[model samples]
Target: MSWPRKPLFGSIRARLLLLLLGGLGTLMLALFLLLDFSIDRQIFGRLDATLLGRARGVVVLLESHPRDDAWQELHELVPEYATGGHTDFVQIWDAAGSTLLSSASNAGNNLQRPPAPVPANAPLFYDLRLPDGHRGRAVGLRFAMPGRADEAVLVVAEEREQVDQLERRVHVALVMGVVGMGLLAALLSVLAVRGGLRPLLAFAAGTGPDGAPRVEPLPVARMPSELRPFADALNAAFARLQAALGRERRFARDVAHELRTPLAETRMAVELATRGAPSAQVLAGALASIDRMQRCIDGLLALSRYEAGIEQAQVEPLELVDLLRRSLALAATPAGKREVTLAASLPDECWVMSDPALLERIVDNLLLNAAEYAPADSTVQLALITSDEGCTLRLGNAAPQLAPDDVERLGERFWRKSAAREASQHGGLGLALAGTLAGLLGLRLHFALEHGVLWAELGPLRPIALPESPAS
Candidate 1:
C-alpha cells in the first residue's frame, strides 16, 4: 500500500540540513573575504617596499657622479631602465622643474606626475599608467645633489602585470577551497543527523510481526539519555493498555459463564410446560430464570459503562447522615427477612462533597451485602467516624466462614462465598458495582477481615462546611 505524502518543509531532516548548511555557508563566506584582504595587503606591501628601494638607489647614483656623467652612468648602473621592451622606468627633475634625465625605456613618453611635491626623507608610493600604457606602481622622493644647493625629484615605476596575475590565481584557489569545504560539511551533517535519529525510528517500530504493540517494556538502559523519559512514558501507557485488555477478556468470559445456567433453566421450564406440567408453576419458574438473566445483563452493562467513563458524577454538598439513614431504611426489609439486626452510630450533620445518587448506591450495596451475609442473630454495625482530614463510614458484620485472603477478592464480579449462596436474589455483582461507582465518585472502597469480622470502609471523604445563613 502507498503511504500518505508529507509536506516537504515539514520534515525534521530537511530542516536540520537547511540550518546546518546555511550557518556553515555564512561562516565560510566570511572566512574567504578575510583571507582575500590579508593576502592582497601582504602582496602590495612588498611591491611598494621594492619600488622605494629602487628610488633610493637612483638618488645615490646621482650624488656620487657629476651632473653630466651621472646621466650616462644611470644606464650602466640600472641596465633594465635602458633596455627595450623593459618593465622598469625612471625619471629625474632639476631644481628648475625641467627633466634632467630620462630612461631609454620612456621613448619620449612621460610618466604621470604627482599633484603634490615629494617628501625629502620618505618616498611616496602610488599607482599610475606607465609610458607603455600598462598599470604600474611608482615611488617618488626629493634628494640633494653633491655640488648644487638645490634638490632634485626622482620617480621610479614598474609594470604590475605579474603581480595582478599572481593575485588572480590566489583568489581562484581560495574560491575552490571554500566551495570544497562547504560541500564536505554538508555531507557530514547529513550523516550525523541520520545517525542521531536512528534510536527514535527504532522505538517507533517496536511492534510484533502482526503489527500489534509488544507487551514487553522497552530497554531504557540502551537508549540515549535524551530519549529515556519518552521511552518510559510509552512503556507506562502500553502497560495500562495491556491491563485493560486483560480485564475486558475476563469480563467477557465471566459474562458468558454466568448467563449459561439461567438460559438453560428457562429452556427447561418451557419444555416442562409443553409436557403438561402445571401452567402457573412453569410460568413462575421461567420468569425467575429470565429475571436472573436480566439482573446479570444489567449489572454487566452498568459496570462496563462506569469503567468506560460513560457515566460522570454530578457532585454536590450532601448531608452524609441523611443519605445513610435512607439507605439503611431501604435495606431493612432484606435484613429483617434474614433475621439480621441493623445498627448505626452517625454524627448529627456530616456534610460531604459527593455525587448524591452514586454515594447512595454505594451505601445501599454495603448495607444489603452485610445484612444478607451476617448470621441470623448477629447485628450489622455501621459507624461514621470524622477526623480533621476526612470522614470514613465503616460497615462491619460477622463473617465466620470468610478468610483474610477472601477480603481481597470481595469486589470481584460474581464471586460468592459458596455455590449455595448463588441461589439468592443477588448475582454477586452488588459489591463490584458499588466499588466501580465509588471509584467514579473519587471515593475509596476497601475491605478487611479481622477475627471473623468482615469490614468494608468507604472513604476518606473530606467534610464540606455548610454556607452560613444571612441574619433575618
Candidate 2:
C-alpha cells in the first residue's frame, strides 16, 4: 500500500516541544516585563525621596547664616551629605539669583539656566541639556536662607549619565538571563519529548500487517500515567488489526488447500469414465467418487465462509438442552450405523444468548469428529451446564493419544493426526470452522487431551447477563 505523504512538520516530538517552548517563552517574557516595570518605578521613587530630603536639609543649614559663609558650609557638606556618587552636582543661589556656592571646583562653569527667575516658591525638577551637551536632571529648591531678608534657592541636580549607565547594565543582564533560560528550556523540551515518545516511536518502527517485526505492546508500567490510556488503546487496535489480517491470509491459503481434494476426486472420476468400457462395478465406483467430490465441495464451501469470517450470525436467547438434544438426534442415525454411541448430559432449562444455528453447527461438527475418531464401541459424551456466571458446553471422547502441541494444531484446516487416514478424510477446515463459529458467538473454545480422551469446551457469551424478570 502507498504510504501517507511525509508531513511538512516532521518529527512529532520536535513539533510538540517547539509548541510548548513557544508558549512558555511568551509567558516568561510577559512576567519579565512586568517585573522590569515594577523595579524601575521603585528605584525612581526612592531616588526622588532622597533628593527632596537633601534639599530640605540644605534649607536648614543655610538658616544659621545671613552671608555667603553659610553657603560655603553647604558646599563643604556636599561630599559628606549627598546620597549619590560624583555625578551629583549641588549649587546655591542668592537673592539676586547670582550663583553663590557650587560643589564643583569650577564654579565659573556653573550650569546656565533660563533667564526666568526661579518661579517664586515653586520647586521644580526638570530635564536639561547642560553646556557640555549631556542630558541632566535638575532639582531646584526655592526657600529662604538662614537670617537672609529674602528667600534664596539651592539646586541639587544629578545626570542622566549615571542612571542611563545603571539601566543599560540591568538591560544587558536581563537579556542574557532570558536568552539563557530560553535556550535551556528548548533543550529540556527536546529531552522531555524524546523520552516521553520513545514507546510510540518503538511501536511505529516494529509494527505492520505483513513481514513486520513483532513488537510486544508497551505495558502500562512503561508509560506515564497521563499516557496510559493512549498506549492501551493503540495496543488493542494493533492486536485486532494484526489478527484480522492473519485471518484473511490464512483464509485464502486454506480455501485453496481444501478445494484440491474435491477437484482431484472429480477429475479422477471423469478420467475413469472416459478411459474404460461401461461395466456395472466401474460405473458404480465412478458415481461414488462423484458423490464424495460433491460432498467435499459443499463441506469446503461451508468451512471456507465460516473461517473467512464473512458470515454474521444473529444471536438470541437459545435453550441449551433443546439445542443439544436436536444436534444429538440429527447425528444419532449415522453415528449408530458406525457403532458409535452418541449421548448428551445437559441442564434442563439453561439459556444463553448465541446464534442457535451456529451453536448447533458447532455441536454437529464436534459430534461428527467424535464419531469418526472414537473407537467403534466408545461413547461420545456431550454436556451443557449453567451456573451464576455463565454456561459451558463440553464434548469428550476416548481417542488415540494426542501430543500436547498437536492439540493446538488440530483446528488448522486440513491438518490431520493420522497419516494413514489423511488421504481418505477431510481434517483441518472442519475443526477450524467450528472454532471460528465458537469465536463469533463470543465463546471461548478450548481443546485438551487427558487419559487418552480428547475433549473440547465452549463458554462465556459476550453480552452475558442474568435473565430479566417480568414486570411486576
Candidate 3:
C-alpha cells in the first residue's frame, strides 16, 4: 500500500524555538506580576507617610492653643487648607466622640470615620469617600492636648487622583515594556535556533543521494559539541551501508552471468525443435533446460529475499537430528547414483531453536552439496559434536578432483570448481545458501580441503536448553 508523504514535526529548530517561547513567556509573566506588586506597595506606603505627617503637625498646633478657635487659626496659618485641588481635612474628636475642632465648615460631616485611635498602636490608614464626592486616603491617630487629661482622635485625609493617575501611567508603561521584551525574545529565539542548527543543515546538504557509495564523513569539527557524537555515529553507519551496497552490486552481476548460460541453451533447443528436430529426446532436453532455468530463478529469488531483510522468520524449537535424517534421506538417491555411501553420526535428540522451514533449507543444501561433489564409491560423512562452549556439525566428502584454492571460494555466489563447470542443473548456490541461512540462524560455517576430501563445517547453533547470549 502507498501513503501520502507528510513533513514531520521532527526538526531541532522548531523544538528549540517552542521551548524558548514557553520558558521565556512564563518568566516574563512572573516578573511583571512581581513588579506590579512592588510598585503598589511603595506608592501606597509613601501616601500613608504623607497623611500621618499632616495629622501630627495639626495635633501640635492644637496643643499650643484653645479648642474653640483652633480650626480657624489653622486655616489662617495655612490658607491653602480652606480651598485647593489637593486639600486635606482634619477632624478632632473628644472623649464623648463629639467633634472638638474640624478643618471643614461643619464637624463630623466630611467622610465615614474610623474607630477612635489608640495612642500605643500604629496609625490606621484606609480609603475614604468624602461627602463632597471626592475619592481619597485617610490616616487616623490618637493624641492628648497639653492642658487636657482626655485623649482625642485625629484623622487627616487628602485627594489621591493625582498619585493614582501617576501609578496608572507607570503600569501601562511596564506592561508595554514587558510585552515588547517578549516579542524581541521570540525573534531572537528563531535566529538563535537557526544559527545553532547550521552545521546539521550543512551535513544534510553535503550527503545527497547520487546512487553511488563514497567514503564521505560529515564535517564534525564545524558542528557544536552536542552534535559531534551523532555526526560520528552517522558517518560510521554510512560506511557500513556502502559496504553492504558493494556486496549487493557484485552479487547482482554474478546472478546475471549465471542465468545467461541456461537461457542460451534453451534458445538453441527451441531453434533445433523448430528445424524438424522435435523428437521426444529433443523435447525432453528442452524441458530439462527449462527446469534448470527454473531452479536458477528460484535460487536467485531465495538469495535476494534473504539479502533484502524483508521476511519475518517464524521460529520454533527444532530437533536437528530429524532434520539431518530427512535431508540425508533426500540426498540418498543422488549419492547411490554415483555409488557414494552417505553416513551420519547424529545424536538421538539434537535440538536447536530456529525457524523450521529455514533450518530445513540449511540442512538440505548441506547434504545436497556433499552428495553432488563426493567422488564415486566414496564415503560422505555427516557428524555432529556438542560441548559446554557450543555445538559443531561437520559434513565432509572425499573429493580427489577438488583443489586447495577452490575450498576457499566454496560459499561465494556462482563460484564452482573448474572441473565441474559443465554441470547444467547445479548453479553452485547450494553452499552459499547454506552459509547465508546458517548466519541468519545464529550459526557459523567454514569450508576446507582435507587430505583428498572437502570439509564443510556448520556450528555454534543457539542451544535449545541453554540460554542464548543477548545480541549486542
Candidate 4:
C-alpha cells in the first residue's frame, strides 16, 4: 500500500523548530513582563517618596510665612527639585480654607483632601480628584502658625496619567523585541541543520553503498568532525562492496570467454556435418557438440541471474528428497553412458526452503561434473542427511587427490586442476555457477578433498513441516 507524501519542510524541520521557538518565546516574554513590571514599580515608588517629602517641607514654609510671594517661590523650587521624568504642582490654603496661591495648571482648582484620623506627625499621600475632574497623587500636611489660632495645610500633587502611558509603550516594545529575535533564531537554525546534513549528501553520491567493487571512496578530512565517523564507516562499506563487484565482473567475463570457443567450434562442426556426403559418425559428433553449447548457454544465463542478486525473492518449501530424486533421475541417463552408478541417501520426508528450479539446476551441475570425472563403473553418490542445524546434501565421486589450493579455488570461474581437464566440458564454469546460486540463497556451498575423493555439498538443511493428506 502507498502512503501519502508530505512537503519536506512542513513534514520535518520547519514545524519542529517553529514549535520549539514558540515555546521558548512564550517563556521569555513572560519573564520579560515580570521583570519590566518589577522595575516600573520600584521607579515609581521612588518618585512618589520624593514628591511627598517636598510637600511636607512646603507645609512648614507656608505656615511660617503665610505670604503669596513665598508660596510661589516654594512651587518654583519643586520643578527644579523633582527627579527626572517627574512633574509637580502645588496649592497653598489659608486657615479659612481659601486658596491663597497656586501654580498655572492648578489655577482656580481646589482639591478636597478628605479628613482621616492620624498622628500630627503623619504626612500621607492619597489619590484625590481635583475640581478639573483629573486624578493626581496628593500629599497633604497641616501646620499651626506661632501667633494665629487657625491651622493651614499645604497640598501638592502630580498627574499620574504619564505612568499608565509609559506602561503601554513598554508592552509594545517588548512584543516587537521578542518577535525580532525569534525570526533571527529560526533562520540560524535552518542554516545549522543544512550544514549538518551536507556530509550525508556526499556519501549518497557514491556508486554503491554496499559491496560493489567499482564504488569510490570520499575524502574524510573535508567533512565536519561530527560526521567523520559516519564517512569513515561508509568508506569501509564501499571497500567491501567493491571487492564483491570485482569478483562478479571477473566471473561474467571469464564465463563468456570460456563458452565462446566451444560455441564457435560447434557451429563449424555442424556446418561440415551438413555439407554433401558427410559420414554418420561426423553427424553424431556434431550433434554432441551442439548439445554441449546449448547446455552451456542455459547454465550461463541461470548463473548470471543468480549472481545478480535475484535470489532475494520469496521461495516456497521444496521437499529435499523429491528434489534429489529428480536430479538423480536426470543425471542417471548421462551417468549410465559413462558407466557411473548414481545413488541418493536421504530421508523420505525431508523438506527445505528454495527455488526448486534453481535447486534442481544446482544438483544437475554437481552430478554431471562428478560423473564425468569419476572412474568408470564407480558410484557417483548424492547423500542427504538430517542434522540439528539443517539438512546436509553431499555429492561425491572417485577422483585424484586435490591440493589445498585447488579446494580453496574450486568455485572460481574458469579454474581447473589440470590443463587438459580445463579444456573439458566438466571443468570450467559449472561448479562456480552452482556455488554462486547457493550463496545467493544463503546456503553454504563448498568442496573438500577426502582420501582421493572430491565432494560437493549444498547444505546444512533448513527444516520444515510437511503437509498432511486429507484422507488416508
- Enumerate clash totals for all models, in the order shown: 0, 5, 0, 6
Of models 1 and 3, which has the larger TM-score?
1
Deviation in angstroms for 123 in model 3? 4.0
Write one digit per residue (lDDT tens) for candidate 1, span 366-448.
Answer: 99889888999899999999877699999999999998888889999999878887666776788999999988988899999
Once superposed on the true structure, which residue ranges of model 2 sit more than 4 Å away at CA? 1-10, 13-17, 20-50, 67-69, 76-125, 131-133, 140-154, 169-261, 276-313, 339-349, 372-412, 415-420, 423-428, 442-472
| Best candidate, TM-score | 1
Error of 4 at 381 (Å): 2.9
Which residue pairs show backbone clashes in model 1? none
Candidate 3 ranges with C-alpha deviation above 4 Å? 1-26, 53-89, 93-99, 102-136, 142-152, 158-169, 196-255, 277-281, 309-311, 399-405, 419-422, 462-472
List candidate 1 segments past 4 Å from native: 1-10, 49-85, 91-101, 104-107, 112-129, 132-134, 139-155, 207-210, 467-472
Q: Report lDDT per candidate.
A: 0.86, 0.71, 0.78, 0.70
In the range 49-159, model 2's lDDT, one tens digit per residue, is 676677777777767665566556765777532333335666777778687666653334575553456666666666666534577666677786665677767776656
Clashes of 2: 5
Candidates 1 and 4, the one with greater lDDT: 1
Give the alpha carbon lDDT tens digit for every residue of 1-472 in model 4: 2343344344435565656677767877787778787867875687678777877677666656756655566646655322322345666566677775666655555666536532357666677765456666777766664445766666777776676577667767776776777777667767765665556655566535464433456677777787678778877776766655665786578667776776676677678867867877767666666666666666666666666565553577877788778878888887898899987777767778877877777787898888777888999888887778888888898877467567888777667667777446553567888887777667899888888888887787588877788996
> Where does candidate 4 clash, by residue pair?
211-241, 212-241, 212-242, 213-242, 390-461, 391-461
For model 3, how does the per-residue alpha-carbon lDDT over 180-257 read when each residue is reduced to its tens digit?
999999999988888878877776666655745447777788777887888788788788787667657866786688
Query: Cα RMSDs of all predictions?
Result: 4.5, 6.5, 7.1, 8.3
How high is the lDDT of residue 231 in model 3? 79
Model 2 residue 82 lDDT score: 30
- Reference-based TM-score of each model: 0.82, 0.68, 0.73, 0.64
